[model samples]
Target: MPPTRPHPRLRYQILREQSPSWKTMGTIAGVIFLTTTPLIRPRGLVGRFPNLHCPSSKFSHCRTTANTATDAPPFQVSAAASSPSSAIDEEKEVTSSGNVGADDLLIVGPGVLGRLVAQKWREEHPGCQIHGQTVTADHHEELNEEGINPCLKGTKTTHKFPYVIFCAPPSRTSDYSADVRMAALNWNGEGSFLFTSSSAPYDCNNNGSCDEDTSVVPIGRNPRTDVLLKAEEVVLEFGGVVLRLAALYTSFMKVDAASLSVAILKKRLRNQILLGCDNHPLSRQEVMDLVTKSGKFSETFEAFTGTNDPLGKRLNNSKTREEIGWEPKYPSFAHFLESL
Candidate 1:
């Protein structure tokens, strides 16, 4: 697992602004990553940390109320919000929400990863309505251009989607678990809900082997990891799936957008936890060697504080592969570079 921090938003902001060249390489590499997944049929897809919304059945004027977790913001709703005629129609729609043919997707966060999922989903299921949710309106225009109906986080609608994916980062909210629970409530349970969590919960600081069964760091030991674990619990309680992602990258790591494909491919997964990473893990020296040899990111090495840098845990997603039937196209960083 990578180092944990109190403020994940700050960390990601710095990473996003690191370099234009790096982002460009990541974008190109991401395309290659998605191509490896097996997409046999059209399934609902919801992505987050960058929510992408697709149209689904409207609410029945009576969304189920859920109890918020401790320290989470209260989730109160007015029961008499809709009129008689609308309520009856919505109730009728809700009754048949179980039908798979009309299922659509909601992506909580539509960042780079979410956008890629939306694009690919559209290619396979052109008639599907995709909706994106964001905290700000900054990217609404872009999302609209991509055929994703963008909406603000607090926006209320009559729609109840079959698939809801919470891909947003914790930095976006003070109480991550509360946000996750709210996203979970948006789903009708006719399909799957997935949360993209980090591998930081694993207690593998020694850079030892880490797998799905690896012991997790004791709760309350690290506030950052605590947030993730709590949020994951919320997802699980709601019968959603969790994907523990390792250091995600295009040029740096092989577990890029492939995880999204797996989510879409396996729609019935519930209360399951899967690890997402390549077969081979590299040390700082090895990573540097590869970059230097490729000459694609030679200048980026200055950002690393080599001698003081901590070792990242070696992640083996063998179980994830067996469980989800996923095999990464680029099984290792070496293979990813060779493709370039």
Candidate 2:
């Protein structure tokens, strides 16, 4: 057998031909990594920054410390309705122990949408404890004025929150998922952790209609979407909820999607992705005309694309209404403005 053995060169060629190609090996390795690896990873830029421990007095009910850095979302949602469509993302809740208030809320990024949620929430639950987190203490006074206890982002509070709403956009941080994970870690699994996402992740084009089941652009397709999807994944992994809010208009109307999501959460629904958009999705021309008529904008209007560019996606929230018994206070943007 030894004498009949093939040459070393021949054996090498045979082995090489029989083995998998580099591409195949790479594909296998990637699959393994994605499947086994945890979505919550080591903190990126946050870990490098020093911690800014928040005082226990910041919120009389909840105690926590803060991390450095702030998140300012780069692009804004151009056309969003306060009215939101609804969807669901499913997962098991991650349980943890702490003296969390039964109706306590934590708003990570207490921006426009965040504060609105707080205001509406307070109106309903006057005694509920509400905490707001910002990158810096610059807004501490403003938040305090609104009756929300202010703290810094990445704050580790003594009492876990029943509801943790992440409203910060991805623009501010180098690592969006890490921020979400931090928020999730602060939750007590007794209530919902809601992440305000955008419709940019949806793959629909040419102003097509997007529903809860619409396919989202896969990761690696768009860097911006990757940030959001990663954050959403982190939320889902924590058995949290995600609300994909469409164009948000704060000028003449208020959106009820945030309150609707809370309604769903109170129903004890977990692991669902919901869409928040008005029942009537408007076009650019329509918006311009409306603003002009309402005297909200005096700038001269011009149409550059002339119907060439794709219209924005029409988000459908029928399921939200059917499932949660939700209806927008204003049926359409025009109706909302007209009411005033």
Candidate 3:
């Protein structure tokens, strides 16, 4: 992601440089960005490439192994030098990567979004362990002072665990491969490597309606797809799940987002007329209540790229809702504003 060649040992270098002062809240944003960039790089990549370590588990292990992708990454060191105990434990749990006993999870870049997802998994699977990685001084401090580091807690199993999650966003300045390597180093496959990429990876169709299976060939010229495209390549080397995430809105998180909508509505009211989108003006509390009450509902909205842009149309989540068994709980935008 960086314009220049990456520093290979950047992770260790960063760990040593300001790891002591990495406790302030201000560092969360920076750490989230920094650690994420390495995830954008290719392994053994120089000149703007970085490296890190991943944990081994029953579900996944990223320490190293032979890869057959066009990227041509060398066989990872972990594959050749691991103990027999490092062999995958396939009888205990089911993994997204088709593995058994996914007892460990490596979560990269812990923050608002990462926290919600990781917290969700933790709640759903009480038997699993999750470790978070951060390189920002403030985040490092927060992690360290909080005793959240796995090594210190005696949580890391030397050989195997489960899966690893790459929740970092891809950016032009990041070293995608390197971040993944760091997550994979000293590692072993646990189960699968899950990458969270943006929907930008898809080409913007003339009608602006596309899904995961859509062809990306047309998006080559689009700059937004550049980072996610590259990152997807690196993650595919591990042969795991890759999720193209949509614009996210979560209750109990980013409460300010709801307030922002309220402010916009009030401003619009001053203009004498109001028309809200089907999903608009929804507040966190109202949405939560709906889920608590009915627990299921569905809706679709017309999403346009631009107001003057004629090449736009509907973008719905019906597919995801059906696949995940989740439906929209919030109904009326008016109710959203009322609850707010």
TM-score of each: 0.69, 0.67, 0.47
lDDT of 2 by residue, 108-132 (tens): 8887667767877776777888888
Tens digit per residue, CA lDDT, model 3, 1-340:
3223122122210111122322222211111101111212222332221211111001121223333222422223331233232223312221223332445565666554444445445545665556665433356445445333322111223433345556655441245555554444423443445555554445443335554345564435766676566666555554444555434332211222222222221121110111111223222223323433442323321111111212221233344333333323334323332332
Which candidate has the highest TM-score of all?
Answer: 1
RMSD of each: 12.9, 23.1, 18.3
Candidate 1 local distance difference test against the native: 0.56
Q: What does candidate 1's lDDT look like per residue over 123-227, in tens digits?
A: 666677777877777888888777778876655545566666787888867667867876777676766677888888887754578788887888999998999
The per-model lDDT (C-alpha) reads: 0.56, 0.56, 0.36
The regions of model 2 sitting more than 4 angstroms off are: 1-99, 250-254, 294-309
lDDT of model number 2: 0.56
**What TM-score does candidate 3 get on C-alpha atoms?**
0.47
> Residue 263 CA error for candidate 1 (Å)?
3.8
